[model samples]
Target: MHVYYYDENFMYMGEDIISEYDEMPENATDVRPKKGLYLPEYDADKREWFESASEEYIESLQPKPQPAADVTMLKKQVAMLTHQVAQLQRGGTS
Candidate 1:
């Protein structure tokens, strides 16, 4: 059997395989979320999974924006210094 876990706010925690004879956890259910376009939430009253739009979840899935252009020169300088240090450690002329 499979058990779906949820937090107090009914947010999804995760899921796990459980023995059919095992007792269900208080915050767990037998319901499984259907594969969908949006995240799913367990509706205890309906005993089913309902799709819910989650901005936080959607944002987290997205790639973070790159660092500002102003930092690029500093990063390049740091990299060059690091490479020089590595060469010095290897007894190679920088």
Candidate 2:
């Protein structure tokens, strides 16, 4: 069965399996809401916060945008090739 955990102040931490956790942390306690209890504002706030946080986390997991290739490196390679071609035209002597 799944169990929800909370901090000492009754702030919800998260849910996990009691078998998996085995022992709760010193500063944490098991939390079980009363049957039929409902808090619309708290539910909405938590849902919104979780949605935003999930989006941000997913974005962070994505590959970052790479920077463009260096123009200076391309220029140097072009210069080297041009010199090599010129030598080839002049009877292959570098």
Candidate 3:
């Protein structure tokens, strides 16, 4: 069982081996905009995306994590507090 993805040029992207058939979108087209055509291969008994291909494709398809403004603000605050703590520690020692 193997899954294959190819670009418009028909170049192989990769392959996966799975055990069941994952339903594709009704509008699924062989042409992937940035990616390419995706094909799934499965064992005769199991009709799914190839395990390797499914895992890799699924992982690749995930959206990248976005940085949060609050997280950035918190980091800045932490840095400021650290500097203030360092200054206080120095003054207390002096």
Candidate 4:
């Protein structure tokens, strides 16, 4: 098992290779954070965030649902009207 060690401030320091039966380190806590939500990686230059593989896999499996057909038609109509209004403002024909 991978033993994740943290600093005094609870910031991730690094990891250790301890046997499964080995006692937990003083600076380390086996109480892992709850799953879900992006996890922050320890980076000195800049902080980085990462989504778990399971989350990514699930997201890939489910693509974003497209807007409803009526909504799409309405959007098209709004665009056409907006174009017509702009043309009128510029003293141009329809």
Candidate 5:
């Protein structure tokens, strides 16, 4: 059977599968939680799974957008490449 685990604060930790005949660990339970934005936490009083999303956690999952490249820098690189190719065609050093 698959068992889910929680920390002392009831935050979901992870899961493990064990033989049905074996004794379940103190921290483990057979209650499979629904997948959440983050793992769902167990509420002992409610006796059911509850989930919540953290703004910080959601922000962390998003990648920061990269800054746009300047056209001037690209133009310089192209010019340099053109000069090098001109020298290469004439059997000169790069």
Candidate 6:
């Protein structure tokens, strides 16, 4: 559920509130026709609504997993390189 506010000139103030569940109207005016209810801001860019709504929805979504690092593989590679350098310093033939 989302609650929106607007000024007299039809300018959007922003979302007043957001909820996971839907909200029912209490009074007649709440259900009555108005200019700004659920209406997108007139001065807003075309992508603005899509972006903001998407972000809000995404924020309500679950978290994702993070990838692991290859620490052992890196250590092995470093050790192999160090051995190669030592052999080179000793003038050893490959």
lDDT of 4: 0.62
TM-score ranking, high to low: 5, 1, 4, 3, 6, 2
Cα lDDT tens digits, model 2, 1-80, are 46655554444566666665476555333344444322211132232211223556667777986545666788889999
Question: What TM-score would you give candidate 1 relative to the actual structure?
Answer: 0.54
User: Which candidate, 2 or 6, would have the higher lDDT against the true structure?
Assistant: 2
The residue-by-residue lDDT of candidate 6 on 1-94, one tens digit each, is: 5554445543455543445464632210111223423433332233132122355565556475443457777788999999999999999947
Tell me the lDDT of model 6 at 27. 14
- Write one digit per residue (lDDT tens) for candidate 4, span 12-43: 65666788899888776554433553443333
Q: After superposing candidate 4, which stretches have Cα over 4 Å from the reference?
A: 31-94
lDDT of 1 by residue, 1-94 (tens): 9999988877778899999899999999998877863666888999988767777887788898877885898899999999999999999984
How close to the true structure is residue 53 of candidate 1, measured as C-alpha lDDT?
74
Instruction: Output the number of the lDDT-best candidate.
Output: 1
Q: Write the per-residue lDDT of candidate 3 for residues 1-94, one digit (tens) a residue.
A: 3444544433445544444567433322233223432543333233223332566777788797767987899899999988889989888632
- How high is the lDDT of residue 37 in model 2? 27
Q: What TM-score do all the candidates reach, one by one?
A: 0.54, 0.27, 0.31, 0.33, 0.55, 0.28
lDDT of candidate model 1 versus the reference: 0.85
Better of 4 and 5 by TM-score: 5
| lDDT of every predicted structure (CA atoms) | 0.85, 0.52, 0.51, 0.62, 0.80, 0.46
TM-score of 3: 0.31
Scored against the true structure, residue 82 in model 1 reaches a CA lDDT of 95
Q: Candidate 2: list runs displaced more than 4 Å.
A: 1-69
Worst 10 residues of 6 by lDDT: 24-33
Which candidate model has the greater lDDT, 2 or 4? 4
Kindly report which residue pairs in candidate 2 clash with one another.
Answer: none
Query: After superposition, which runs of candidate 1 have C-alpha atoms over 4 Å from their true positions?
Result: 54-94
